[model samples]
Target chain A: MPISLPPPSEEAEAENTLAAIGEFGLIDRVTAGRVQPATTLLGPGDDAAVVAASDGRVVACTDVLVAGVHFRLDWSAPDQIGRKAAAANLADIAAMGAVPTALLVGLACPADTPVETLAGLADGLWAEAGSVGAGVVGGDVASSPTLVLSVTALGSLDGREAVTRAGARPGDVVALAGRVGWAAAGWAVLARGFRSPVAVVAAHRVPEPPYAAGPQAAKAGATAMIDVSDGLLADLGHVSRASGARIDVRSGALEIPARLRDIGRALGVDPLHWLLTGGEDHALAATFPGSPPEGWTEIGVVTDGEPAVLVDGRPYAGGPAGWDHFVR
Target chain B: MPISLPPPSEEAEAENTLAAIGEFGLIDRVTAGRVQPATTLLGPGDDAAVVAASDGRVVACTDVLVAGVHFRLDWSAPDQIGRKAAAANLADIAAMGAVPTALLVGLACPADTPVETLAGLADGLWAEAGSVGAGVVGGDVASSPTLVLSVTALGSLDGREAVTRAGARPGDVVALAGRVGWAAAGWAVLARGFRSPVAVVAAHRVPEPPYAAGPQAAKAGATAMIDVSDGLLADLGHVSRASGARIDVRSGALEIPARLRDIGRALGVDPLHWLLTGGEDHALAATFPGSPPEGWTEIGVVTDGEPAVLVDGRPYAGGPAGWDHFVR
Candidate 1:
């Protein structure tokens, strides 16, 4: 027997449009069903959330996404945008070997925006925060011509020392704990008008950073660490310049995920380009005093030389430079 | 001999534009010379800022400012934008009767933005946060077509009860702790193509919230509270609806600064319009059981009736309706 389904509009009925729903109603809908971790003493519903700083210290970071610039409405759902914003900020805290505790969000959009869309965005933020056992503690709402989301993440170190970009030493092994260039390859596939038979599109919409690996790297005595929001070479270059060391990536040892390669082939682009130049993968890259802990892949080595990045002992420049906010 | 002064630009030279300055250098400049309060165990320069929730809890809020919608580039500088953004969020914390401890900022701008512009924004945020003895602990940077700033503030209650908007009772006295309608009058002068007096113009640029007044009210047994970011009647309406009380305002008793009245005269607009309908003034409004604290002025009384607000026992209907995100 066939089962009857509710009409599409009814099944997806929103109480009111954002204009009709108003800010307070939209906020209530967005905050429902979210669980606050123990670290968050007070969560949503108040003016601000209070988070526990157990070690008497906290780490914080923020990132902003603008419609048309960071994401297109046609390409990404509001939920995806919310998750990506939270992930990006959380990754920064992870890069410092800190465990995320709470997040504060700032959103601006036109009044006519659907309340359901805003709710979806809030759900995405809650989902991403849940991944790290955190909560969306507070947020702000305002009217604007376009959609803009600003996220701030707070973290606790659990008494571990913070790993900075300035501490990589000569002879240290460079290792990575997550996928690189996957997001970039996905972007290339979309940009070049190629339909890839893979999840590259999903990767482009929502990046999955190695949240645990950051703290793990810190626990294992990594000298310096950074999240690969910029391209691999550009991000590693930060470590090189800060530590006054040369970083040499060994191409053969680098791991390029099969999905990325599949997309690269479909787009008629070299996967290596994405690996070297694409950013927003949020992979954790670190320099270790000895062999890194299990699950980390060694891709390069720190050498006592000029502050620069090299591929196979030579300066390589063959792809679009990594993400730069102003220098598009 | 009088020394010749170079152009204003020459006095504030930045070593690099935002793009040239890069993210790290810009961050360093934006965070230089600011001191953090004891409640902030850590400040900017890390992935996230750690603040002390001494009462085992914290209050947090966020607000965003868009270049053209919130403030015009010609009318306000980056510094003013920064101050306004911080003030908006801080006021939310104050509405909860909490003491602000730290701030996180997310900035989006074109790559060509001057480094000095960002520095000035940071300076303004620091200036405002400093007024409340708070610090800016973390932030993010991104590229957008226009300037967008998102700020999140974290606050502590010092083991006091949170004064929500749901506690007003019949026969309670309604009081206010800061100036009303100055910002609206200043905005009117600017909109009407008339130059306001310096004080009025400054009020329009940056609102000075009565920071200490919130905690003081909480200490003096305020029944309910809210900040006046959305005009007097509208914000008071929130208290009335939440607490199930009717609030009646005695406009004669309200302290409308003389500077605002003069500016209203110049603009050929009713000063009461500015006082009753103006927003972004960041004043504190609360309901008390009896007499208010030392500096607070009695503005109205709470009554046992349907949730509504009135002026002198009658409904007021003269000014433009209160601020609404979607509706104009």
Candidate 2:
């Protein structure tokens, strides 16, 4: 057959790989046609980005997600992985009771990676940031054998004092907002070679962190707060240690979601154990001197004692307390 | 040699690895006994750190350093690698005429990495931040096969307007602060298996960016500025494109340091060529309407022409213009 050429558009799309387009070209492709929020005074392309810090204070945090270590490409799409990475850091800013303003990403991947994959990641990051009125202000990309993303989130306190993990008093009530254990339950289902329970599987793919609830709890006189990225009991243990107080969680108040319970029953497991020890849901947990704000459920109370986390007045027997990246 | 153990201190030191100490333990070891500057409203251990952004706006940027791509462990010590990573991001903030206030790092490495290596990296980061009265405010760590560092730097403009790269005018004089070509020369030397000239090799391992000159040039009325991270000609190309003007460099103005000249002679290469196309020294280059600021050497002028960088009124005829992480 004689040599034939595709249309110009088709040829361009076919040539849109990282090595083909190069670093600058990939950057332009990903950042093109994006809209930044008002908080972003200056966006990408410059040496650095300028962002508004209206309260004279900025809240900042970083999270790293490595392929295979944090997620499997076969399990989640590029956009979902990007959203998860962005959510992980943005939730940290929220956990400090601040309003997110901007994010800076550092991506390292193989040279053969597709431009479309990077664009999808950028799209997901932008979508998540836009949900909180923030922007992806600046980032850098380089070549590597493994794909890794480092996301840094910056936020404004809006002139309010930061609700630190050390502020909970003995009389404060422990409350929870958003979902917990759903992602873990999703992981269990997926590990068992079943994907029918779309609800939990989708949860595993993307966490729906309660971003607004953090500021709500702060405005409602929350003494201490944290993002439940580990397990409920494990994260509560952090609050207990930081506040130098004892916490007793009432297991009956957990109330596992119906979907998780059904999946657990199908998988021959107890949903409550997942609720107590599962992680990656990015839920908001806090201590309130009085009643928690709307959307928060009271689950426990802080008591004057040594720093420890107890379930129903005693330690609960569970498989593991929480997730640790490195084995001891 | 009976089966008697050494002292408890010696035993503990020998067992200090990432896997043995775990994630939280490593965090504690690195953060313990460190003093944060006043700009750090809150430091590590919380979900996020609160930093003082005295100005209404904050300058932020991120840079990624990958092992074997950005630096080789055998060529540079862990501390030097950390400083290089931190300096790369901090210089970007300075390029925008901002004073760095804080850094957040995201590290991914093998589980078998030593705690001592991580501590060395943290020490280097802290030392560099302290030089500018800043702090290592927050960071995250994870396990991966390859080591990757993503550092985000946050800075304040001190109420001055940012000197963006798009502001260069037709009648501007181009100037430079800090050294260029030194790191590239050092890399050449190292590649040739000669480590003698300690000066250049040290420069390659750890760059001394003229951070103070950035805000000084801004105060002295620089029209545009950029961090010379890619190469003098290549980075100036960025200024030309961003500002929509042409820059012509007087090759003789870029004086070849005697040390580099000697090394180049021994290697059968022209040091002037290195001066034009070498990168990674993180020097600051800027444009001024009138006389350049003190400590800045004027080497060229911006003219009304197509966006391009020229050497002696013509294109440079030496080698590739700059470095790119991926091939085109």
Candidate 3:
């Protein structure tokens, strides 16, 4: 809860919502002394922030998280939502084999939402971005009926070729880094009103993405790469179809982490289902022509055939399902 | 009304809302055949888009707009909303004295929102971005309770120093390019149910910012610049406060555009009031140490007396009248 709010000033603080202090004051509270990486030549309070480029190019990605759809206010705090939103955008940069440099946040919240909440969101944004040596460079705030966060991440390639989904080839080993199915398991635990094992609940709130492994995989000659944001099988399908190849996920090869297994045993659900179908984990799934670099676990292979993702040569049927905002 | 939806194909066209087609399906419909500008090395359908950076740095800005607050679906078409959203962000880039190169959009709409509406929105985005020689490089779509648009624009400094709000000094001439108070006038016309002068009504739906004059003024050695977003006095106050100088606007020297004057005459309101208080014009206001470049109209001068925006050597008395999202 220690978000390091600025020293109390004439501007009204947490007693009232953002409406009391107004937009400009809220912006000041959220952005005061927010740290920036070296890539940022300028930070907030400008028309635009100037960021250093790599290889004469910049990698940019954006994501929007709606309050009711992407997260529940009752279940998650402002810091958690902020971190998740930042992670989602950063994961895309990592998926592209790039290093994140800066983030521009666009936040829309109800007028009655607390200014402290906004400050906490900013704190979480800076915390998550700072962990990866990036900065929250610029931001915009507006009033809406509900909370809507749109985050744009800018990254640098560091003079390396970007790994795309279209590059997977036959005989390539498909590997993954970072934890899988933990966030999904966390969501399940939270949704069912079961709060035992606090880590599971926390995972659902904040996702820890493998940011560095992206550039490392590209360096290790990753043929195809994607951040597993929409289930392991679902996202791999994109790589498979784009590469015009078949990806086979060996079920035995996947090691379900202890927390996921604990939740599965308590709920009587298969942990593998969450591992394969639970999304929002944001782990790196890549296909390498040779050996994968350190911290990567080989879990599958790419083969020349129909563009399908098969688990142990069989197609995976989704479980109780994970988060999909649009589909009813 | 002619939104120019893509030709019907095997995919579900306007028959279904986003919920009916699912998220990936809706994405396919929305992104198909999206045009990319030449600066984009890669466009949508990837984890991230690679945009060409100029002078080893990229200028970035973001803005958030919510439905029913910033726009209304009943009053404006999807295309108009899309164009306005894109214009707002591009205007910020121009305020930085940079050339816009690419945009990343984040959209959150209700599940019941029609696919055709989304497509039309995409068309509007492309049309507006194309007019500026920029591309919609990438975007994220999600479901929310209401429509929310968060736009991030990336611009190129093009080897010129960014003309920030803090660069102005005493003895600089204050100049302006593009229209002022038009959008607010249009909003007033729309709110009052006046039907005459279709141009005013249309202006409320779409803002036309002078995108070219930003880089031109920078090339001509602009001291400070800002987009006239939150009224002339309010935004000018930002430049004045940041630059530690006073800006004096000579009302007799100002020429109220003919259309604004006609609207004011018909409505029996003082045109000067709207000229000073009305916002959302997105016109470029800059300070020039010497004579301003071509197409810029000199309207005021900077003074060393104080850090306040004065209308003919007196302070603006309009209290709590400008755009503040949180104040009801």
Give the best candidate by TM-score.
2
Using DockQ as the measure, the top candidate is 2
Return the TM-score for each candidate structure: 0.89, 0.96, 0.95
Pairs of residues clashing in candidate 2: none
B136: Cα error in model 1, Å: 2.5
Full candidate order by DockQ, most accurate first: 2, 3, 1
Q: Over the stretch B174-278, how does candidate 2's per-residue lDDT look in tens digits?
A: 999999989989999999888869999999999999999999999999999999988999999999999999999998899899999999999898998878888
What is the CAPRI rating of model 3's predicted complex? medium
Query: Compared with the true structure, what per-residue lDDT tens digits does model 2 show for residues A107-191?
Result: 9999988888899889889988988999999999999998999999999989989999999899899999999989999899888
Error of 2 at B47 (Å): 0.7
Ranking by TM-score: 2, 3, 1
Question: Every prediction's TM-score for the first chain?
Answer: 0.93, 0.95, 0.93
Tell me how far the alpha carbon of residue A175 in candidate 1 is from the true structure, in angstroms, after superposition.
2.1
For each candidate, the DockQ is: 0.49, 0.87, 0.78
Off by over 4 Å in 2: A1-14, B1-14
For each candidate, what is the lDDT?
0.82, 0.91, 0.87
lDDT of 1 by residue, A105-192 (tens): 8888877788867888998999999999998888878777768889888887888888878789999999998888888877776666
lDDT of 3 by residue, B1-328 (tens): 8899887764464347888777778778877877677899888888999999958899999989899988888778999988999998999999999999998999988887888888888888888888899999988988888789999999998889999999989999999998887888888887887744778677778889999999999999999999988888888889998899999998876787788898899888777777777777788899999999999999899999779899888876655436888875
Pairs with backbone N, CA or C atoms under 3 Å apart (clashes), candidate 3: none
